[model samples]
Target: MTSFSPGRLGLRAKFAVIAVAALLLGGVAVGYTLRSTPEPSTGPAVTSDGPERRTTGPGGPRLMVLSNGVRSSVALRDPAGPREVSSQRCERVYAAADTVACLAPAGALEGPKLLVSDRHARARESVRLTGIPNRLRVSASGRMVSWTVFVGGDSYAGSSFSTRTGILDTEGGLRLDTLEDFRITREGKPYRAADANYWGVTFAADDNRFYATLSTDGHRYLVEGDLAARTVRTLADNVECPSLSPDGDRIAFKQAVDGDPAKGWRPAVLDLATLETSRLAEHRSMDDQPVWLDDRTIAYALQRPDGVNDVWSVPADGSGAARLLVPQANSPAPVA
Candidate 1:
């Protein structure tokens, strides 16, 4: 295993190392059936008159988040309001429909694991895994789940790290331990590379189509995938961490600044129909997978100087200023 220190690498090299590490590695997927268990809850209770009583307006939708590693949630209607925290700790988490996926925190003597649960926090399934969890996502239909982890090395300043990404079909009980097994087509021609890496997967509404980032050589590309066929085709270049809009017409992604990772990245939106890109109002470098709060709004985490992360939102059309949505929270996913 190799170790990388961000402080020793230049801005561009730091991101390059991270992007490369996030795209490499291969592994096996182990699956297990989980027995239902109650998860203890903390924080303010949602009483009938509380801010979380309704599912809209003053109560709006529920926004799942990781509060200092605890699985917590807040009402979108009152994002700054009290949160309902759970005892289940995770390094990364995401929720959709009835499914909630968590990358359980590693123990002193044990490695990290993936836990699948229901909306009420009832465990459904668990998978033993390796590496440090980085990203997690659930399909809109709750039938598919995916995750990414750093298998070797640490930080984003060096080329010593490797990444592994996996996907699971909850309904079919099929697992793809690594995207490397999938055939790839670049520029309408078969492509192969031992150093190819893939990560930041975002699924389509159909549950069969998906998208992810593929890094090889010195280039990064956005690849559209077909789960059943186990094939992926390059869609565009310099796109990373793509989050498809609810309408499926646009993709919210992180674009390497000026076609150079050393320069950092900017949050931007891509119109799938025209291949035109729209850079958001946020000028700061964001190293996150943007989530769609709705068809018109995109939200992502921004780390503050104090190392605390806050969820911020900007208009997907690139017309409005960025605004804080949730303070002291990250890995946001909207749930009803």
Candidate 2:
């Protein structure tokens, strides 16, 4: 197994991306069931140490990360005044509307665990997963939670890069282990491809309508998904990891260049109405699905030369320079 790193884009990061591709390739979608895992004793429900303090105020939400790569916490511009959110060490976290979802590996051979908690970082529920978790997301209202993981196997992802993506309806108690069952339409025609894979889900304001990346037959598509209908239709091609803007009009995503995925992808934004795509400020290969800092800016984790991770933000319009937001941060989720 490749070792995972927050700051380095080494074999581990390459395998992570390959695993995501395998996930969409139907490598682990046969008769699998999605269920929550028991809360690990290492998790936090309440702390007798004292009440948690407010880390951010009217300025907006603070950035959430695994502080020191060991403790789950949130911080302002700097890591100072870091407020502990959970005791369990999280590999990734997504927070919105007072809801925080943490994805942490259970063991070297076992799959990861998903911990749902309040804004205060108190545990609410825990879900056992079947793979190493990669991406984590929560809807603006926190009613919809989605996750992507690498499900290793011999049949897919040459290097055991198989992946599995799932969604949990927190309010309705419904779980879709894999989008494999969802009906799909490609190029405006009813399509049925056994190799199809879906991931990187971004919910709309209504939640019922969402967007995600669907890959099949060696091609990737930006798909508009309907939870109610359990259906997804291709909206555009070459887009992966679609993150809807806070205003709901634009999406931050990665676009594969020259129709060659192996060449790597560039960060860009797409307008839903006009279908206009604008490249972001960054020039390096971005393996992340960027998070919108607000309606105007986007933030993502970047690896420094010394293997230290930092959160950097850039204007969504492709006009400004990328600026560092927090040093030593891996997953940068807004406090909203």
Best-fitting candidate, scored by lDDT? 1
Candidate 2 yields a Cα-based lDDT of: 0.74
Q: What are the runs in model 2 whose C-alpha is more than 4 Å off?
A: 1-52, 55-60, 71-86, 108-110, 153-160, 305-307
What is the per-residue lDDT of model 1 for residues 68-130, given as tens digits with 9 covering 90 to 100?
Answer: 777777887788767766667788889999898999978999899999987766777788889
Local distance difference test scores for all models: 0.83, 0.74
lDDT tens string, model 2, 1-336?
989666677888789888898887664453231122212122231222222345332234566665444434444544434344434567777888867788876876766798887865566778999766778889999889999886764222222245678898888889888998899989899999877767788999897898998878877889999999999999888888899999999999987777665676778999999888999998866667789988999888777678677767889999988886665667777774
Instruction: Give me the runs in candidate 1 sitting further than 4 Å from their true place.
Output: 1-57, 155-159
Model 1 — TM-score against the truth? Answer: 0.83
lDDT (Cα, 0-100) at 295 in candidate 1: 89
RMSD of each: 18.2, 17.4
For every model shown, what is its TM-score relative to the native structure?
Answer: 0.83, 0.77
